[model samples]
Every structure is written in structure tokens, then in C-alpha cells.
Target: MTNPPYGTAPGGQWPPAGSPFTSPAAGPVSSQKQSRGPVIVSLIVAVLAIAVAIGAWFRTAHSDVTTQSTTAPQQFTTQQTSDANKALCDSYHKMFRSVNGAGGQTSDDPVLQQVYAINIRLATHVASDFMYDKLRENPAGSPQLASDLRDLANAYNEVLMAQLADAPKTELDPLYSNIDSADAKLVEACK
Candidate 1:
């Protein structure tokens, strides 16, 4: 038997003429609006959010343990300050005494060099510990006093090193003079 002929959809047309959606083959490409603008924006936002989270995590992970403060700790007691100054002086005296007491163990001239090296090392360490770190530990300590102490300690150390190096007498004389001047200032400040 013969099949019935295909019939028009309506109004004698092959298919419905007017519809909201159209086949891609039947419509112009420009007529189809691209939805990529919003998608691109969403992707960028997600990437930025991930980056910020990673940065925040690293900041918290590797951070040092310290309090955030704009103010220094309370000052030392008057008696405490005096005692600390005395301790500073006493420590230096002890160091000198020990170095001097080690004399006569050897007649080799190199022994003096070794002793001088030890003195420089010891003096540098002590100065850093007492003059710098000690004052820093007490942040509320007098800044001018700290400055004087640091200068004095450094001046004393420079003279010792110059002497060890056997610098010319004129250079040695200036270094000694600087030590004496720094010492006078430190003494006044400590008092």
C-alpha cells in the first residue's frame, strides 16, 4: 500500500514558522548569544578566591610566634638597673683577669696571638650579650644609656683588636683615646 503524503504543519507551511528556539543549521550564528561572559567571570573569581586562601594559609603556617605590640615593656626597677650596670662592669673585669691570668704558659710569640684572638672573641661575645642583648631585653631601658654602653663596649673591643693586629702607634693611640672617651660617657650614663 502507498503511504499518505507528508502534510503541512499549519497554514500550509512545512513546519511551524515562528518559534523561540531554532536549529543551528537554520539560524545565523550571531543570533545565538554567547553565555561565556558570565562563565569567564565566575572562573576568574574562583581562581582568585583559591589564590587568596592559599596565601592566607601560608602566612599563618610559617609565621613566627610573637605578640603584636607598639609599646615597650615596663622599665626595670632603680635597684635592678644599678645592679645590672655593676654586673656589666664586673663581667668585663673578670674577663680581663682570666685572660691576664693565663699568661706565662708558653714563650712562643704565637701564644700572644692566640691569646689576642681569644680576647677579641670573648670581648665581642660579651659585648653583644651584655651591651646589646641585655638592653634590648629590657626595651624600656634608657636608649641613651644603651647607646653609650654599646659605644663603650665597641670602643673597648676595637682597641683590643687594633693592639692584636699591631696597628701603628698613632692608630693605636687614637683607638685608646676613643675607648677612654666612651668609657667616661658610659660611666656617667650608668651612674
Candidate 2:
């Protein structure tokens, strides 16, 4: 006798007809093959991106070195040195004239006199610095002038500090003498 739902096949097999467990007379089923073209293209694109980044870095580094190598120190001619010296002397003379002019004269009021003195000292300091810079650019041309300007600047600084501290006249005398000596040397060097 046969079962009701799970009945025997025509040849009395266990499974029913047309089920997957029943193999066909031909053979087993075959699956489709996958392609590797897309994967290979992706790998090539990634390698190309890395190469481009490395090339750009090298190019930037080379350009920086080239730019740094091109710059050279300046060489001053005799005429240029003379012109620089004249300019320094002219600037010093202008500052000297301004300091001795009417605007720098002492007023009757003590406070006004103090202000004038401070202004004169500041002007002298600035002029000295300017002349020093000019000499520094071509120190070989006028070393003596450079030395004198340095001394003058130092003396004036001492005098300014003394005046600020209300030092006695005796204390200021030496500083003033030093300034005068440096000034005379500068004049001679300029000539």
C-alpha cells in the first residue's frame, strides 16, 4: 500500500515526482563564472593616485631649493659707499640743527624745559641709529664712522638716563664730554 501526501513514485521511489531531491537524467546544474575586470581597474586607479601625490611633493621641494639658491649678497660700488656716507652725515647734521633750533630751546617753565630735553635726546638717539644702519650695510667703507656713531649713541643714552634720575651736574659732565668727543670724530670721518 502507498502513503497519502508523500506517496511513492512510479517505480516505487521514496520522494514524489518532480522534486529537487530527484536528479534529472541529464546531469547537475552549472553556475555562471564571475569577472575580475572591475577589481583590476580599481587597483590600477589607486596606484596612479599615489604616484601623482608623490610627484607633486617632489616638484614643490625642488622649487623651494631653486628659489633659495638664486638669492646672493649685495656688492656695493665706491660711488654707492660715498653716497651712503654722505647721506649718513646729512641726516646727522639735520638732527643737530633741529636740536639746537628755537623749538629745542629751554622755556622758563621747568616742566616745559624737561619736555624739550627729552625730545632732543630722543631725536639724537634716532639719528644715531639711522647712521649706524647705513654704516652697517657697508662697514668696510667707513669703520671709524661706525665706531663714532656707536659711541655717540651710548653716551646720549647715559645722559638721558641721568636726566631722568635727576643726577647731579658732576655725574652728567663725563657723559656730555664723551658725546662731544664722538661727535668730533664723526665730523672728521665724514670729511
Q: Using TM-score, give the best candidate's number.
A: 2
- Residue-level lDDT of model 2, residues 54-146, one tens digit each, is 744653332332242245634768887677677767766775676567345767865556455555655554554454455454443444554
In candidate 2, what residue range of length 10 has the lowest lDDT sum? 60-69
What global local distance difference test value does model 1 have? 0.54
lDDT for each candidate structure: 0.54, 0.61
What candidate 2 gets wrong by more than 4 Å, as runs, is 1-76, 136-140
**Candidate whose lDDT is highest:** 2
Q: How close is every model to the real structure, measured as TM-score?
A: 0.40, 0.51
Alpha carbon lDDT of residue 87, candidate 1? 60
